[model samples]
Target: MKLLINIVRWVARFLGIFLFLFFVWFAIEIGSPDLDMMSNQEVKLFIGNLIMLMGLIVVWKFEFIGCVLLIGGYIFFSLVNYSFWIGPIFPIFMIIGILHLFCWLADVFRIAKKISFSTRLFLK
Candidate 1:
């Protein structure tokens, strides 16, 4: 159980880092020579979304914030002429975000309860 928890933590951290880096890379790519390359933007957008989702899955807390940023980023990316996953698939992300939110809330409360119990015990 301990090992599994550690593994989950590591995976979440890895996903967060990768998602952040991808966002950076996406910004740089669009800011560079490929600025006018509309043809390939959809591909980039899909990849970005995929990376973001992985991060979302891995993150065990503050998922709502993460998801909001992800959605906002995707919107901005779209405005700049970035093609999304499969035929206007922006809603797909929304659906995932909603699901993630529920799971995140559960985890957050569970963590909070555990911490509260431990703190109470320690105080006693």
Candidate 2:
């Protein structure tokens, strides 16, 4: 179980880093949009991307919060774009978020198990 958890955690970390860098490169290639001229939807999309990017950055130190941000940002972006099927990147990030969520849950359960064992030992 520990090995599995580590594997999942590391995989998610690598994928997140790759996605972050890819987005940065893509943004640089495309250049920045004029926020003053952006429509409401475009602005929303920008915000969603920012949130997702922040999630990718924060996930390095905090799993659960990062997972929430990633998933939430994806949803926000999808809704703002009026479509869920925006190529593969959105789904890939969603999968990464799910992976992080699983890692968080595993850590929580492991800690709970240890605490329970210690409590039982103390009671006896």
Candidate 3:
């Protein structure tokens, strides 16, 4: 059980990091105007990049916030651009966020359980 929990925690952390890096890369790509000179709508790209940066920051300390940002970005972009590619990306971010959240909760519960058990043993 302990090993399993540790494994889950590591996996969750890895996913969180992956999500952060992905968002950063995405923001850089979109925010850069040189590569996408054909597109005249620079404002939209700037806004998207800002959102991604915010999501990256929030996700570092708070998984839920990060998840919300990522999922929200996916929805917002898809609706604005009417693109089908976002359909697949949206779920991936949502899932990663959920997994990270669950792992965090599990760790909290595990710690609480240990404290309670230790207290009971001490009292007895």
After aligning candidate 3 to the native by TM-score, how far in Å is the CA of 122 from where it should be? 2.4
lDDT of 2 by residue, 18-79 (tens): 99999999999999989999998889999999999999988889899999999999999998
Which candidate should be chosen as best, given TM-score against the real structure?
A: 2
Query: Each candidate's lDDT (Cα)?
Result: 0.56, 0.92, 0.63
Best by lDDT: 2
| Candidate number that wins on TM-score, 1 or 3 | 3
Of 2 and 3, which scores higher on TM-score? Answer: 2
| lDDT: the better of candidates 1 and 2 | 2
Each prediction's TM-score against the native?
A: 0.41, 0.95, 0.55
Q: Kindly report which residue stretches of model 3 are placed more than 4 angstroms away from their true locations once superposed.
A: 32-86
Error of 2 at 69 (Å): 0.3
TM-score rank order:
2, 3, 1
For candidate 3, lDDT tens digit of each residue in 68-114?
77657655655566663655544555565566566667777899999
- Model 2 misplacement above 4 A: none
